[model samples]
Target chain A: MLKNVFVLALIVVLTLPGCTMEKKEKEQGYTARDELLGTEIIINIKNSKEAPGACDDIFERIKQIQGKMTVHNIESEIAILNANAGVKKVSLSQDTYNVLQEALTLSSLTGGAFDPTVGPLVKLWGFDSKNFGVPTDKEIQDKLNLVDYRQLQIEKSRDTFMAMLPRDGQAVDLGGIAKGYAGDEAKRILLSHGIKQGIINLGGNIVAVGTKEGGSAWRVGIQNPLAPRGTFLGILQLKDKAVVTSGGYERYFYENGNRYHHIIDPQTGFPSESDLLSVTIIANQSLMSDALSTGVFVMGLYKGLELMEELEGVEAIFVTRDKKVFITSGIRDIFQLIDGDFSYEQYK
Target chain B: MTVILVMNNINKWITGGLIVLAGLSFIVLYIYQGSQDHGQPVLVIYKNGALYQKLNLTKDLHKEFNVTSGGHFNTIEIKGKAVRIKEADCPRKICVHTGWLHKPGQIAVCMPNRLKISIEGRSDNVDDISF
Candidate 1:
């Protein structure tokens, strides 16, 4: 009887907190894992128990949602709807409808700066899987006729959309804003499932939820635009904040020693010619951060800061062609300029 | 007697497990800190252009490299082991203000006349690729 009692006590002692038993789980938890999203989508999330599975779940959801929304996939609802162009109405899933509605609203807010209807121009530039060489001015002009957000109508009441594209084939690609929106959704899903502290880095768009272990803010390093890799211009402390950087170096084909990137200006229908090398936007919303990073990069310095100041919670860091750093007032306090070539200038 | 014997063995095992865990934790901490360094060579700036500090792959501090007159303000060249900064004509001493490159991908710059000191490391295809 005494032996059994001692055994019971031993089990309790081993299972209790601060136990020296080797098999005992540590109070402090750490995890790291990779999540594959479709063919191209892969996101890594580091957290406690909810990490590995949550990351995988988020990627799976992204694939499922992308499959439904991608214009490239003929079987996708978006492609099928676009195939029957000049239609009266086409119904969409809630997720698709939500993304489109948000894109339209962002388009209005940025004054067509963040238009989803830019797909026509994207394809014309051959950035569409083919990445065909630059298009002629006349060809771009012909395609530009069908690339207006005002023409694309969204009826939120019925979750249906209608777009008026030319016969030459005007496509509406939500590629720019979709990834960010998906990141935001993935975070929301993770949080709902009791996973609090983590970061979702989708390409260059990063979202941090909650603080690190021991209640430390997540230290996020922004990449140096000119530097190749693992080189940071500075570090920012993100506490439940989403940061998205749009740079001239993210994607481009170099021919004859000249670099051509993915982010194209709608007005000229070519790569943006702003002095800014990259723009990183920090906000509570991932979609907004994503949308604004691209929009503000195209807006350049003056107008970009103006927009940053007008918005209550938006902060931006801009690196110009002259290697000068420009950041908004709010951003200056949070940003630590570690080793950039130039001092940071606050553009009113 | 049996209980006492078993208890002694259990206590020994517990202590052994704890020592093992403490050692493992220490090793883990060391690795984490080591990986974080990221292999950036350190370059410390000093007066006279003749005096400077250079840290190699092992990060062993080796101060005072031989300065050669390269016409530019203290130019630090990392050919094999030695690094030298050339002549500096600037009166403000801005080049001397920029410090060492401890992180793998970090770069220090003196923009007055375009002088760049950087740590060059192999690119690890990181997701975000932050500095």
Candidate 2:
């Protein structure tokens, strides 16, 4: 009897760890990181045998999109379009045309606050180069003349799509929207690979594909713009959604006692002087969140809040310069304010 | 009758010993589970998409090392539970400027050299951050 009891106890003790090991194997996750579109891209997928191959496919797709849309690459289609401005209508790839269509739609929706033709102003402000300086008022006024999104003409005839800038100086820069589009594309790739749980982070634009392991919502932190990177003002419980933030803190230069940021307002031709320091948008699609974050940041707090309330399935969190945090009604429950220094309020 | 009584006493002793043994094993399992750091953080370094090194941050130690790739080098320093890129030959020095990183999910990257250093642990409060 004693021998039988000892043997049974030993079996139970030994099998416990084995059971846990099997559970661990089932929850295995794979992560890969690469540099694409001039930023760090990290893709993490859980419990998928095709993760590595899927990540490769996703990166390849993003690189192909970058080749067509990046203004930094002279051979890119966007660069060619900029070069041939007012001279001829340049043919566009399907991907580029689709992204442009989204950009234009966002521009109209935001009432020109998120214009795609702000490239000349981006260059004149030295954001495209290492020389960061404050441009003169006259220079900004001249660049603003070329910053209109309406001047960009897109024509689609049956199978062919062509785009042209009606003026020589006008150019289109998709820097604000391309990363979000790439993130959306990555999520599609992950889903196609049977990866139900994943996180796609293109720089700071995040696309949470599904609930985390065990069906818990993924916790995504919102950056504290006033503090250094990695510090968060709050966390959002997200599943099958995208979050994109626009802030002047990302790129800026200090000249004398003033600071100039990179998000040039199409109307003012200057870094946005909006009362809010940062704006974050969350939606079902990364492309919408990405473009709307920029436009809302430039639109200021009240107007931006109004826009958020009007839009369905779109939520926003705005951090004002005075350290007031405001969230749209939709995200009031999901967003948890972690930082005590900032006061949180839900906009009516 | 004496033999029967002796056998009964022996069975009781055996049953008591078995209960004590099972109880001890359960206590040991509980301690083992408590000691396990399920979410212990780790510092991971990647060079050109391949994992270069992984260090257990729970260990108390101070160390510095140089990682060279393609004729370029970055000096990484680890102190206590934190890590940082102390120096690098890259022109921008963006990685070095990133400063110390101690929390899980924090990352510093040297894009020119294709080197990235990040803290990763299952115990992270947030999976990713949006800026």
Candidate 3:
């Protein structure tokens, strides 16, 4: 009896310190939010305002990236590439070259399921301009012919790089990967600016700098695919990782009781007919997570699962239209389902 | 003596079981406490990513306000718990189409006008951004 009491007392004593330790490490971090990169940018820093100019420097880098990669910007490198399609190879900065290369790799990895060259299809569907109009069958077919990631060719020189779009009117859209790149840059800038721990939320792309206060895992809510932005089906307790979800609900239009979303399929030249409502990917790098989320989202569940299985250091949580949650084996313990309506089926 | 020993064993068993049960309940309670909603909903408006205004949604009020950013004006309407963009000078009218923002975590963005309205912290921070 005495021994049992001692053991119980020991356990209590051991566990009691953690609560106070957590309280001691608690720091009222700074939070700043901005509307840049066509998304909300929320930054949280624990304990100090060591670098007040860090945000300005970080946002400047983001804007520079946006200006470089956006096809909309006439002076942007991407716009120059689109202009020279089938005419000439446009010179690209190292940043543009690297992102384009990574995008091409992800495109092949997902079997063209997520194509950067799906710009024509995206435009025809009226998503880029948000006109909310459907393209004619002939128009889709014509655009589909031009929607090939393979056709975006690259040639590297000593100092600079050049890229060619094989067909005229073919364009490359870095929407899928640019934000992730921007997020990583933000992380680098924050670290350089003397901020030890932070959370960089560039719209949907979340790059957790370090663990929350007291070395506890940050509780990041997984947005419910069917509900509003803040409504979540689950919470991912994570530290020092990027959690990105590409949902069919992000941009959609309802016409005649039918919901048409913005994730255009490279094959069908329309929105992907995937049964999935959202795909949340957890990865070490924000860029890969950003690209893979879109790729897995476009690939649908089966192929997406197969791809994730082959890849190393990546886990995914797929939410279907019926609200059934399917998570990879890795995230089982890490992901907690908060919403009782959504059920997570354990895959064999 | 034998009866006394038996009673002590029973006492130990019950106490051990109760300790384990208490430990389990504490863990469960800790987790439950972590995800609980923090407070009532607050309507937060952002212009160019900065907090422009924060209004309590529970307040019984109906007012339409215009936020001008970079020469663009977005007319925002807040009535009770529901808030929305009633009108905007922007061409897309996407903010108007965002319909109504009632629930916590819902956000309506007027991209061209650089205006965004979001319901502020009533619960846990976003763990995994779904969209």
Candidate whose DockQ is highest: 2
The pairs that clash in candidate 1 are A231-B131, A232-B131, B73-B87, B74-B85, B74-B86, B75-B84, B75-B85, B75-B86
True contacts kept of each: 0.19, 0.51, 0.48
Candidate 3 lDDT (Cα, 0 to 1): 0.82
RMSD of 1: 13.1
Model 3: residues with Cα > 4 Å off, grouped in runs = A1-26, A47-49, A130-132, B1-40, B59-103, B125-130
DockQ for the candidates, in order: 0.10, 0.37, 0.26
The prediction achieving the highest lDDT against the true structure is 2
> How close is every model to the real structure, measured as TM-score?
0.68, 0.84, 0.82
Tens digits of per-residue lDDT for model 3, A98-117? 99999999999988988999
A309 in model 1: Cα distance from truth in Å? Answer: 1.0
Candidate 1 regions exceeding 4 Å error are A1-49, A158-168, B1-131
Q: What's candidate 2's DockQ score?
A: 0.37
Chain B TM (all candidates): 0.35, 0.68, 0.67
After superposition on all C-alphas, the RMSD of every candidate to the true structure, in Å, is 13.1, 4.5, 7.4
> Between candidates 2 and 3, which one is better according to DockQ?
2
- Candidates, ranked, lDDT: 2, 3, 1
Q: After superposition, how far is residue A6 of candidate 1 from its true place, in Å?
A: 37
The candidates score, on chain A by TM-score, as follows: 0.85, 0.93, 0.91
